[model samples]
Target: MYTGNLSNLILNSDSYKTSHWAQYPSGSEYLSSYIEARKGDYDVVFFGLQAFIKEYLSTPITHQDIDEAEMVIQAHGLTFNRAGWERLVDKHGGYLPLRIEAVPEGSIVPVSNVVCQVINTDPEFYWLPSYIETALLRAIWYPSTVASVSHYCKGIIRQALEKSADSSDSLTFRLHDFGARGASSQESVALGSLAHLVNFAGTDSMTALVAASRWYRMDKDMPAFSIPAAEHSTMTAWGRDGETAAFANMLTQFGGAGKSVSVVSDSYDLWNAIDNIWGGCLKDEVQNMGGTLVIRPDSGEPAKVVREALERLAVKFGTTINSKGYKVLPDYVRIIQGDGISPNTLGSIIDVVLKAGFSADNITFGMGGGLLQQVNRDTMSWAMKASAICIDGVWKDIYKDPVTSRSKRSKKGRLALINQTQGQPKTIKLDDLSTTDNLLRDVYVDGKLLIDDSLTTIRERAGW
Candidate 1:
């Protein structure tokens, strides 16, 4: 069995030792959320917290843990509240000291709004999440940002399809996840790719598939699918002289399966592979096989390379313009740009290729960092702040309003997300919170899991 280094396990902030004062009465009940999509006005997808709570909240604080934790604090030249912590442990019987209510994972909540509420159920444990905030924010930040980006990209593809393709049937597969190697960690691959899979069905990251199946209770039929394809290593293993053999080999293997095959063509010469090999040599095989020949360009300017490749493929294999005024490539051939694909670049690439007369159906996107890791909490200006504090058997509205920047000011008062039956959702005070119909559900309480949603259910709720 693998054991961790003690220093890494035992180290923590001195502020966490006594930081409850850093919060209003020390991290009291607070309703916080992705109140603003500083990245843009895009709605935020509330997700990943269920997974976080499931993994981390399976057990609660034990007196032994508190005693050991207290020793670490005192060793760091900090005050350790042995009695205070023991009281909390004794009262809660070692469960998490907090309660969390969130909009169902995958519910598209307004970015400038509340998605969850964090409260200390036991007064003695108010200081607990003062340290836990980092992980909590992280749980919300990663998946929410990733889901937002993917959702926006999906909207772009949907628009491009409506305007450029014969049908929008390929919307789900237009943007594929090729970010596993680009993600920061195994957990990142799971959270980021699961978020993206909320919007798209094509993913090259198998690690994400396992995560969705295990955590979200999903099957292969739901989100994420991949096709048989060749990478540079697979081609180069055949040697450049054997490059023709590589192409022939790929076609020979998957061509007869009546499914699409993607070939990485830019290893030695992109145009040569597209013309001499894919278009020239395998043209008959591709046409007669009843499956697509996906030409993937891995280098060069995304817009320029994709546009130019489409032009070459059209000249060699031919094309037909769709009713939408954009030309459609022959059904047997298409271009998917996996290199340097992001929301911004993905759009420009599609536009340039479309202007060159290729339908959006003739193109797809595969993104790495931009789709998975290229974001921060500030990307959406997400924050979890105490809006209200319970003291003296009364709730008091509290917030920060720095005159230096109004944008940094936090929301005030106990909050309720009033998701209307026929109107846009609004945030109101708890006193005015009359509707039990509010979308927020108690997702985690103390040490118990209150909700568990499937990937299919999430996708349906997210309007996929």
Candidate 2:
């Protein structure tokens, strides 16, 4: 009945996992903590560990389940230790005896080292479950990567918006998540979408929308939003000859005052559709309908095509200078460049738009693979390692100082993330920090979600 990925279970044996289990010191679990931090590229890492609460910690595997797993792996001609896993689970009544303390959801945590910590909170259970490390950590890397990438995209757009838009409040909705279809799986879509929603409110991925709500305890008032739009199939289905009819139908459906609709214009000649069909035939109708028409160019050299398209649109609907001295497109017309968009390239495209005398507010971005799926733990160099271990009621600092890569060296002792705008490396010993001032709070402890963050609270912290 469970016919999904067995990779994490079967293939993980090859991660030299026996060594991982053996590395921990004997009598190591009076109270030990490991920090999960993005150790490279990013200085401040946004926390998006909500998915693990539902998928891993809440779904406990019994001793019988471990025995069944051993049989399942042996079916593939590989050896597994059912007895080892069952013995570990027996100490805690088939539940993981761990506590996860994290910077509140959406908190901008300094990654000069440690952000979230996974520790054995219960003294009755000695030795942290080795397999659970991989289980919980695998869930964070993807969502955290997406959230980090998406958060910086907001920074890029925010800077551009401050220079061009009259009001900078629309930065959150400027980049829409179009990544659900391109994600590796539906579960991948859910994780990536919820991560994106931490900073922005726009999405085209209904899979993401539904998944986030289901897993994160989100209500019907979902954190993400979307607009009516057509894909290549929907547009090309009408045929080139019936292009005008297709355009007319979209107008009839979505072209009302303040309404936003995206119509793909490159199914045929991109220019002819914009000039003849949309501008030539429907210009007055668009003006009279009093709605925003989002012209989507799915394929072409991004900077050149967007600049050329915007120039022609300015010629058709006309433009006015904003207070920031950039040309602002008419209220009813805009451009959306959905292809070839990454964090850097997207900002550059808007930079080109600003050079071409158009405000950044006139264009928004919809990202697919780039926004959600096409990154890894290395994208931000995420790692979770044992930093402190307690033996015989003594909390001793523990770390790995590899001579080859000093950056791989782990921090020692518990962590408390501090928000500092100075933009330098932030490091403080846990003993030096007061409990009230520490940003990392108890999130999960012994099969209970201690602190559940509301979507609004998360949004506000993310600079809503």
Candidate 3:
């Protein structure tokens, strides 16, 4: 929906980038910049670049956009490159003359390797790559960070299930997305939630569905699904006196054969809802239901509360031991911990359940702000730096080696990511390897998208 001036690519950069058009060396004819995450606890899930290229770079710049950018930049005390933009519009049909090569979307790349390389196809626009760094880096880092976090959580859950569960049948639904409302904007909701969906099939974020359909070519087969669930307002609206009635309503509406429903049960006293009401009053109603009832506790120390809730629920509903010797509740009951979940806490909660002799299948997770808003560009120390530049048809290697922080040092020369049969992928200079040896694919060139990845394709590459 962002149209007119807001959608103008010329205005998407930082105001200082306007001045950068003149800051480059006088004979600078081409500049090469590459993006990489210099440090992190684990490998990254490289994503979102395809979506950005399709959404932003595919649109041709118009004369009106140049005019609007000129007025805004001048009024804001920055010089605008009107003639440069005009020439781009006139000669290149309004498309940027840039070639973007990147690792395949959803590739689980290790830290400190080049994931994307950007260089101008037309030497006249040497500054284009660095000028668009603001938008380009933002596009790569945010969703890629979210995806990495979600991917890490998936590994935690999978390990727990392997250690304690009889089967990993519910692995894909182990972590649910509850981060939509906690996101900073709808775009964040869409991109962040979609990144989570790459590793899981459960979500309550609908914006991610629309985005997947639009950007990742998921229209025919949607990548995520959600069940009918209740929040605090719905439970409390019936009054404390009518608490049992609200529980009954959810069971009546969504509880049936081959169906499930989630109800937030911590509005008042979480223990009372589990012990007095669900255990005493509606115990029979729950057991006789044809489908599973997921009880969500939204306020507590996550690990302690989940362990206690699992113990209390087993006492009332009874539990059967799986082949792995871990206790699992009957098909009619389950627990979901939606409070205080983040990458840091996720592994501990799963570990706690496993240590308590409970099957990982007996529980799922719902993460909100922790999943979407908790990360930033610095989560993995992501940076886009000029590694090489061309002047008058001669190329020279360039990079920064900050003595203050060795981790901030960057790579030099034109980089290429190549696969190694034995270990991690290697980042080498392009001159050392033939073009065919590089794993970096030309995904975008002169306004044309060469690789259109689908959600299914991304899921496969991410090891889903």
Considering lDDT, where higher is better, how would the candidates rank from best to worst? 3, 1, 2
Indicate the residue-level lDDT of 354 in model 3: 86
TM-score of 3: 0.97
Which ranges in model 1 have alpha carbons more than 4 Å from their true place? 1-18, 21-41, 219-222, 420-422
Best by lDDT: 3
lDDT of each: 0.77, 0.74, 0.91
What would the TM-scores of all predictions be?
0.91, 0.90, 0.97
Stretches > 4 Å off in candidate 3: 1-4, 434-436
Error of 2 at 439 (Å): 1.9
Tens digits of per-residue lDDT, candidate 2, 1-464, equal 75544533323334444334445567666544555554644444454566677655665557656755665666766556555566557766666677888777776655555667777766544445344556566676778778878888888899999988898888888999988788988878878887888888899878766766666666447777778898888877888898888887888998897798889999988898888877889888778877888999989899899999998888888899999999988888888889989887887898899888889988999888998877877777777777677776778887789999998877887666654557433556678776436667788887887876666677777667
Which model is ahead, 1 or 2, in terms of TM-score? 1
The candidate scoring highest on TM-score is 3
Q: Tens-digit lDDT track for model 1 on 213-324? A: 7778764455678999899999999998999899888888887645899999999999898788777876788778878889889999889988889888888888887888
Per-candidate clash tally: 2, 0, 0
How accurate locally is residue 118 in candidate 2, as Cα lDDT from 0 to 100? 79
lDDT of 3 at 47: 88
